[model samples]
Target: MTKLERSQIDFSTFMLYRLAEHWGKSVPDTYRILDKANAIDGYLVPCYDMLHTLGSEYLVNDLTDYVREQGICI
Candidate 1:
């Protein structure tokens, strides 16, 4: 599929997969930290990790990089 078509899909797995593949990062086995939690909880997990452990700026960098590398249109 073309990049435009691929970007139209609503699959978090595929979006993250494309980013990780492009970046050559060791993408985790699972995207969600908590399988049972809601999106707010899941989003907060990463937010907390960045804020306390890696710093908030790193989180912004990560998000920016992910978007740039993934070509995630949504």
Candidate 2:
């Protein structure tokens, strides 16, 4: 998997949106959860470690699929 840059706000937001959709939670709530869990890095970047900590393998897989579909190179 490509490493997503911490500066990619649009990409990060899209991931958050997709995660929220998959988890059936509101976007803000999802952010809150990640924030509380310290899963988000500075600048709101989400990493593989975060996903693993959250036990969100399905979400990670979905994100990979989404990135592939979008042709995003990290």
lDDT values of the candidates? 0.41, 0.55
The C-alpha RMSD in Å for every predicted model, in order, reads 12.6, 11.9
Candidate 1 lDDT, 1-74, residue by residue in tens: 86633433333344345434544554462233212223223343334433335443554445544444545332
Q: Please give the RMSD of candidate 1 to the true structure.
A: 12.6
The 10-residue segment of model 1 with minimum total lDDT is 32-41
- The clash number for model 1 is 0
Write one digit per residue (lDDT tens) for candidate 2, span 1-74: 44445344545566677767766879898666555544445423545445434434565465545544545432
**Candidate 1 similarity to native, TM-score:** 0.28
- Global lDDT of model 2: 0.55
Candidate 1 residue 54 Cα shift, in angstroms, is 0.8
